[model samples]
Target chain A: MTNTNRRVLLKSRPQGEPTPANFDIVDAPLPEPKDGEYLSRTIWLSLDPYMRGRMAEAKGYAANVNLGDAMVGGTVGQVIKSRNPKFKEGDYVVEYAGWQSHAVSNGAMSMKLDPNAAPLSAALSVLGMPGMTAWWGLMKIGKPKAGETVVVSAASGAVGSVVGQLAKAHGCRAVGIAGGKDKCDYVVKELGFDACVDYRAAGGNLFKEIRAAAPNGIDVYFENVGGAVQAAVVPQLNDFARVPLCGLIAHYNEMQPSPGPDWRLLLVKRATVTGFIVSDHFTDMEGFWKEVPALVKSGKLKYREDIVKGIDNAPEAFIGLLKGRNFGKLLVQVSDDPTRS
Target chain B: MTNTNRRVLLKSRPQGEPTPANFDIVDAPLPEPKDGEYLSRTIWLSLDPYMRGRMAEAKGYAANVNLGDAMVGGTVGQVIKSRNPKFKEGDYVVEYAGWQSHAVSNGAMSMKLDPNAAPLSAALSVLGMPGMTAWWGLMKIGKPKAGETVVVSAASGAVGSVVGQLAKAHGCRAVGIAGGKDKCDYVVKELGFDACVDYRAAGGNLFKEIRAAAPNGIDVYFENVGGAVQAAVVPQLNDFARVPLCGLIAHYNEMQPSPGPDWRLLLVKRATVTGFIVSDHFTDMEGFWKEVPALVKSGKLKYREDIVKGIDNAPEAFIGLLKGRNFGKLLVQVSDDPTRS
Candidate 1:
């Protein structure tokens, strides 16, 4: 088996918005697995906005990616050689393998991905963290009722797409906030959202636009993006509105506290705002897996993937993700998938 | 009856912090009680931070106080004249009687007050809105486990004192944040709080002081103040912390949004923040009155009221209340309590 592995290391922390210089791409030899460990070749590397938080030295839910260490991420990989009884050679698995082509694991965080049920790449995207995030925030926290207006930011992206679709499934008016005309169009047309507000569009106030879109006022807000988008939606919230704060992607690159409206907005609406980490609520993932895939298989729940080729390009893809450049679930196809053709 | 009602009217909206000029002292003729109606003389007027929100023309939980209208507030009063069967003459009741010395009501939002049980003044304080506010936030939202650390801002004030005492009763460590050393002393020494930090002290960071007070990290936060105090508390919050946002007195006077940390602090901690209006949760007040008085009777709960004399002093007292000049629950004794004297 080839021992050579290519890795992308976090060279330096970003001051504000991350640039390519902050990442160092290098080739290295993979170490052999001892006793209870196994070697896995990366098939899919996830490029998420969460990685931006991991890059900051500032305190967050996850530890920051230290200088000269592999930038931490979720990945789908296939075992090339095994020293553990639980995993065998050619078996596909999903794990936190970071930004590396090869990883040696004792299988503490790794979970077996069924190759027959779905594509191995789906493990790092749809059928994995992002899917659970959308499900957990929408069904668990947002708790949208039938005929209620639910709004999601970054609505064409990974988690937001699922949130809007799930809102529709639950008999809600799903209004999405997306970056451009294309994403906004895709969010409404392809993602089956009731309406999509183009945040990039100029002229009238965005707050007024959101109010017009959700005329009865938002009841369930799936907060994946913060800043002007959050400011706009907060005032338009109905009494007893629910905000499931899944992400703050818009403020991840912010140098200082964003100048925004006070908690008075939340207080005035008597809203419930909850911030949750997907890992903390994984007990419900089984229910999500059982439900979402069936919806996906029947074409009732559709998904889009933005697959950028190779591990070296992961840094640029991740940076673009923070800038709202990626249209859907962003992934770095690091190597050829053994589970697929 | 004299038929003259002394009132404090909201003459003009304050530019920033409310001043004496924003209020107008006026004498108006009291309307005669007609069929199915009654007239009540205000014995005790309750001054709360929530009134600040009502003063703002912006959308909030309740309607804004229109210019030249009597400022709204809760008041405990004796029914002087009654034309209704439910409320007889000379019976005590609590109602939203605004800032007027006398009011006529149809008994819609009025509740009979027990004059024999506690002081009629207690109907507007410990045994009333503020006490219930503390209980609802601490139990419904905070949900503190035994031995968990709970932090509350405005610790010596009406709601905070109750919250701290309640936390202790529930077997939780209560750390308080107050504006001065005297209030801090009252919170810690008198209220049985584990510790209290003086937010106005020099040199040391408020966050550091809070961290020191709550060594294990804050599990539940009762947010009454929301400026530097909130900023300090947010970072010290432990994972899965609950925040019952009852008020933002610190931001109430602000012309714009206070520059503070984003909700990322909450998201990273996986915190639950609920903003509530006590009026919406009055169904549980029956339960509060039943249980809380028992605790108070057994010396498990202690309350102190900072009572100001005269209906004329209400405007200045309310202005001082915003400045944190009052030591405890701030209330204006409008007239001689028929039950007390």
Candidate 2:
């Protein structure tokens, strides 16, 4: 283990798409575990679309990451030192440890990880925030009934993959809107989605292809990447359709705000569009932990990770994530996972 | 009483807004009631903003008014002839009697009106579709809590006026948006809304005026008029805010569909925006009738109607209504109300 903590800090807020100049990497002395706190070596750092909102000065659902601070992120780590009675040396934990090699936690929101049940990194992917997001948003908000058509955007990504799979489990036909042919293939063949529309390839035909894919019209739309995709899906929404708007990654990088779908469609269709953040619904965590991990263990749910090596490459990889360059749940492996063979 | 039925027919669909050319009035023979049917002399014809949608080629919540057909409308009439056991001569009834001096009804959605309980025309305004629309949309969808601010557009109009009063009754701070000074004054002084912003006078400062009116930020927005007012109100919505999209009167006359407010605001506020039409929720009618009419009788729920005279003048008054020229619930009194003093 390194004696120094290499941390990436927010240098500036991005006007549009984030560049490497907006981030600053520096080596600092490893943080010490004070009384009732434990220091953990960050093994995996999750790069999510929401992190883009955190870097903006605009008030989002959550607070923005202050300038010159370590960029906030979800992390899976191993405890190397401890001062808290609840934690011990060598204990694995999933916490909001930010973009660093190590972090000190008072164990407020940190959860103890069981590497034997699933890979430690899985806690940062399918078994973690993204998975629970899909479960809660789809079931509670989307409310897909049997024989309904459920369509999800960014379908190959962390949250969306689980969304499509869960919709299928609920006896709804799951259709996916993805960026490329490769991702579309993975969403349909590997992830077991009924069909997947390649938005990149479809170009002007996106709406037509989506309409063909969701022949009976969309009953529940799991909105992950909003923009042109949203405009297309909205017109085809069935009467009393539910839209669980989890993310708007398409607009996160824009310099100016874009207009949403014509609301006349909502009134005509009697649709329900709800915008939500998973953090506000933490009360569902208990139920999620009970049901989701079992599904992951039984091979009912599948997940993919685009793992980038080293913390130094995180800025570039994150930039790629916003542009749809990375497939699946984008993550940075800061160090080796001891549980992985 | 007139021996001929002076019916208004839909000559053509309007391109942007309805014109006199779009309608054709003709004198036709008075219809006889069939075995199960009843003939009535039309006393009041309710002219609502939703009629604009019915005249359009685009598919709205309900079916479009077919060309050459009598323009559909809600009416309060006195039954002059009856073949059905449910009705008797001189009995007041509220039914879809169209834009004519007389009509026949088989009693599908027709409601028996009691002039003694409240004014027979009250069934077409305060106790009818508009009142029920305001009641259901605000309570069921907006779901405003005590100490929260509820803002509604089209403040002095039939639905919006009732929405503000109901919001006030629910312990919410009721703010309204109307077109001009007179309507704004009537909204605040007579109907008891906390404040009313004049959208025509506010100009570029519309949002500023609205923000000032709703100092605590809007928690519930009963959307009766969309477009600029919606764009202005959306930014001030607080966390977990609810928006019951009841109408888009502002966009109803447009040749092209206008864009809705930036959805990013919805995401940031975690708002629930649901679109609904009162017709779909007729089950609420029983509860509404039991509760709302009593409020009207006690003078708790105030109402006003802008009554125009004669069946030949219906087209002009309807055109004026679309332009916000009518002050209150716009209605055309086709014939004398014997029940009225």
lDDT of 1 at B26: 93
Candidate 2: the clashing residue pairs are: none
Highest-DockQ candidate: 2
The residue-level lDDT of candidate 1 at A24 comes to 93
lDDT of 1 by residue, A1-341 (tens): 67688999999999999999999998899868999999999999988888888888888887787899999889999898899999999888998888999999999889998888887777766688998899989998998899999999989999999999999999999999998999998988898999999988933579888988999999999998888898788878899999999998889998887644568877888899999989887775777977899988788888899989998888888888888999899999999976666
Model 1 pairs whose backbones collide: none
Off by over 4 Å in 1: A338-341
TM-score of each: 0.95, 0.99
What's the C-alpha lDDT at position B148 in model 1? 99
The weakest ten consecutive residues by lDDT in model 1 chain B span B256-265
Per-residue lDDT of B173 in model 1:
96
